[model samples]
Target chain A: MTRARPLITDLLGGLVVTAIGVAGFVESWRMPRFAERHADPFTVPGLTPGLLCAVLTVLGVALILRAMAGRGGAVAIPILEWPAGSAQRMIFTIASVFLYGFVLFGNVPFLIATGAFIFIFTIGAELLNADRELGLLPLGVGALVLAIVAAFAIRFIFVSVFLVRLPG
Target chain B: MDGFFQFLHAVVAIGLSADLFVVVWATLLGIVIGMIPGLTATLGVALVTTLTFTMEQNTAILVLICVYIGAIYGGGRTAILLNIPGTPANAASALDGFPLAKQGRAGEAMAVATTGSFLGSIVGMLGLAIIAPWLAEFALDFTSFEFFWLAVFGIVLCGQLTAMDDPLKGWIAGFFGLLVAMVGQESLHAYARFSYGISDLEGGFGLLPVLVGAFGCAEVFVVMRQEATHLVASKVGNVLGSALSSFRYAKTWLRSGAIGTFMGVVPGVGEDMGAWVSYAAAKRASKNPEEYGKGSTEGLLAAETGNNAAVPGALIPVLTLAIPGSAPAAVLLAAMIIHGLRPGPLIMITQADFFYSVVAMVFWASCAMLVLGLLLTRPLLYVLKVRREWLMGAIFVLCVVGSYAIAGRIFDVWVMIAFGLIGFLMRETGFPVAPMILGVVLGPILDNNLRRSLSISQGDPLQFVSRPISMVIAALVLAIILFSLPPVQRALGLVLSRLPSLSRKNGDA
Candidate 1:
């Protein structure tokens, strides 16, 4: 009940770490050593990375071993347990972030893109609020107002005040 | 003496100028941000760093320093009233603070916290002024070998201390951060390591964006995923009067401040540990240990003092060694570079006046926190009442803008989101993020130095530990790793458990 995934999470985490380590090491080995240019062998671009990936591989193995031995399986990892309705909230948050970062930004005008994102986010979050204080009309109006003010304030601060050349 | 004069000059100049007003507002802003549950000191400093991009260098650093100090102190108020620490650093404060609030002594608890924080900041500021110059001078003789070992030591020690229970995961995070830092072009060769033919990958990940993502955007997800918290104490009574009364427990604050300052000096292990260590020490030394978690004023004072003092304590390494002592200090270090200020072994010789100005900044920030905290105690409770649903959207938008404003690249925004997910996953998996952040900061230092050292030493690994300083640091790194191993830990536990029995048997004999 306490552990989110128990020994299985560590088992998976170890496998992933080990895979990353191997991939990284292989990639490092593929990097140029500049032997054709008679560059110093120790100064190869891949030297440090190769060494780090080797160490990582060993640590990953150790983690797997520990998990197999039932060590570190006593308690739950932090932030895994949550109240009801958390999954929906988390999924929505991830979706919103993805849409804004990958699609909305750099595609639409900064003001509209940012305002639309904020407005949608605010209203969506409020609707998810279990203890709703405001009715539909008031909530919509409030969300719209907040979105407009916050969006304008952010744009002004970044562009006009800070001189950042943000995307249109 | 010369340094003291420069310190005095900087203090007087800042006090007399328009910067005084900046101090008030910035510190106030930091308090409000800290008073909120999800906005951490790291996030606060990072968001504020974006704003300072257009200001003069010193002014920017000033704004950041004020925010750093104020945020640490501000978190204590939430711990007192809501029984939830506004920041991780204030978690220890809640042990005593909440009980006192439940006992209808919220005002007294806050007063003790304020006084403790002020004292801690002053003590830490003194440590910074005295320690930075000496450490800088000492580091002047360090070769690439020493620097390489220092990076290893920072990563290892940070991993060990930050994840006391699970050093394995901590080290994993640290190594992963180093790997992340390797994804761009190397220093000696301009070849991109893992760019995979992508154009944006050549320039590498921006530090600010990664930070904004990990601390800021990740905060949004965590907040949304959790149930909301409610405030306990509806009223904060007689703040000013209660504050003055805390001076009676001078011993606790002083001891905690000293311990806190030392903890701050340790790389990547910042204010949270500072408060915890100080609180533990205060409990150990207290005459009435039973009163510790049940409304003890002294415990609250120690926790607050220790955390606040660590703010200045954390700055010591950032100024002298270009290594951050905490997560927030990491952002500060990056901001220093952003503002065209070089911080390293030669900083004392190169930026003497600037160093003194930082000390003066800490002084002013502490004073501002004290004044504002005591006077506006009751009014500040309104901050805790704001609903998360209403606040999360604005906070997320700021995270986006903070990342974008840094380099004005949409790619950076993507990096922020990516790291935010990585950070969220890291937290959920029980891996400490600070070591990873520290690894990202120290990766280049580790890489360049190791490669350079090997080139000079002709591939002899022995040469890496030849120097006295390098040997000492190498030994420390080895010791930490060895002690953290599961077999070694179990053996030590068995031996320690047997020691008391052996002593008793000897007594019986």
Candidate 2:
């Protein structure tokens, strides 16, 4: 993409970092010192976190100033550089994940929730793949079978064998 | 002499027992995990740690150690067959290995990797056995001042090395982790700092949940976001023959093993650097440097050897000082504590036998990796072909359960998702996640020692720089920050640029 993408990221990220630093410092400073209990002054609970937040605030300012000077480079990790034309797919995945984790997981029965999640995720992802060979009906059939086996097998192993006591 | 017998006894005890079954299966599982493009050794070891919660202490450590060693070695298979490295440690292997595969020499590349990995593990095992006791003895002299400085030194050095181009972001992530650690109760007064009357916040974030989210859950998003990969080579030609002939590259593996072990000993640097530096070093010393990146066996061997050697090398600090040398080692250290075994300073005096048992575990795991890698080379290719569409759903499910299993708390699952999003954002913005995890691991050590030392010295800042060891560590931390500055780096680049010309002129004269 364009060089300006990282520049924008840096600008936004710098602001968030500064915000977190400022808020963290205020919270740390508000912590009790235990002076009333005759505790050691040097061992006050606020001292270490306050110092860390102050340092963080300085670094955040540096990042913002560097971005303002137009000196930040593009994202450097090669593995993290995602290819383009996948926005629709990404949105689908994230939405499905949020639905599963936030709404479905703890609210429904374990097997039903897990199996339905796997089925929907598989069918949805396969439909998004342009190179797919399977028809939709066949894909759904396969996904249903796979999801059932996986849900039962995982529940049996974790709950019966390892004895984890998984949530609803 | 006595140590040798202790090591020998430990080896035989494990060798003749039913633990051999556990060793092979754990290593095989590790190999499968590493062969998957999105699965990292850290995530593999962390998830397996959940499975070992009810296991006996030493047995649990044995299984984790096997998984750790096996996973690092297993990633080389993906590097050769597919262009993608299974784990970051095998990124260097992908350079020469994919080329070799394209040339119909994939079997040879796999053979070279297996032999090289085994040799590297042996060298690192020797280093661990010989050096750990002495290091533990030296650490006994460390007081709170030294520990405080040590903690700072780890964070700064790790941040600098992992993100040298952008040390500012690395340090920020580390400090943020430390701030996250401060949310729980303070040890001195037991007064919660940032809990805000929430009962769950008083307990702080669980390390496993954060780790699983950052590495495991984040990986699911990253995998689904990227374009899919394919395996390029299907033919497994004469693997055993190439395996026998790969022994001729002795000098390359030996050198790479030593280099990898050194990198592993450096906190937070880990196996990725071990592979890269070893590959570069091998290329420089090669008779035909042009052959590199064009299917050079020496380069592939060096990469594999270097990465595997770092495994045992990373263990030294974990056993001796309770400081992990890498991310996966960080999980192993946490697993040690969760299993009720303490590591640091007094290990040699109190837990010497257990230390020897760990070395034996490494040795057996390396052997298991070699045997399994050769026998299952063909069958394992099926694993790489599994569609990400079908696989990621199950993987995310495991991530949720793994996080929940640690404490049976639904809040931890929420923590996992939160960190997963944060980790995804951090990666998108070019911030490395290793330093953040290292920061989490070192947080308590830094906080505890910082307050304790200050109380002892009654707020005399001079005391931090007064003792010899503490002063030396402080100086090192200063030097790292100074050298990371733009001006200092520019100056060094200029000087380094001139050195090559100066050397050439001297040779001509």
**What's the CA error at residue B118 for candidate 1, in Å?**
0.9
Give the alpha carbon lDDT tens digit for every residue of B1-509 in model 1: 99999999999989999999999999999999899998999999999999999899999999999998888988998899888788889999999999999999989898889989999999899999998899999999999999999888888988888888888888998998888888899899787888889988988899989998988898898888877788888887878888877788788888988889888988888999999999999999999999999999989998998999899999988998898999999999999999999999999898999999999999999999999998988889899999888788889878888888887788889999999998998888878889889988989999999999999999998998888999999999999999988789899999999999999999999
Point out the worst 10-residue segment of candidate 1 chain B by lDDT.
Answer: B236-245
On a 0 to 1 DockQ scale, where is model 1? Answer: 0.75
lDDT by candidate, in order shown: 0.89, 0.88
User: What are the per-residue Cα lDDT tens digits for candidate 2 across B1-509?
Assistant: 98999999999999999999999999999999999988989999989999899898988999999999889988999999988898889999999999999999998899888888888898888889988898999999999999999888888877877776789888888788777778788788887878899988888888898998888888888888888888889887778888877678788888998999988877777888889889999999999899999999889999999999999999998999999888999999999999999999999999999999999999999999999988888988899989999999988888888888989988888889888888877887888888888888888888899999999999999999999999999999999998988889899999999999999999999
Question: Per-prediction TM-score, please?
Answer: 0.98, 0.96
Docking class of 2: medium
Give one digit per residue, the lDDT tens place, for model 2 in A50-165.
Answer: 88889888888888888888886644644335555477677888898888888888888889999999999999999999889899889999999989998998898789878899
Instruction: Provide per-model DockQ scores.
Output: 0.75, 0.63
Best by the lDDT measure: 1
Which regions of candidate 2 deviate over 4 angstroms? Answer: A77-85, B494-509
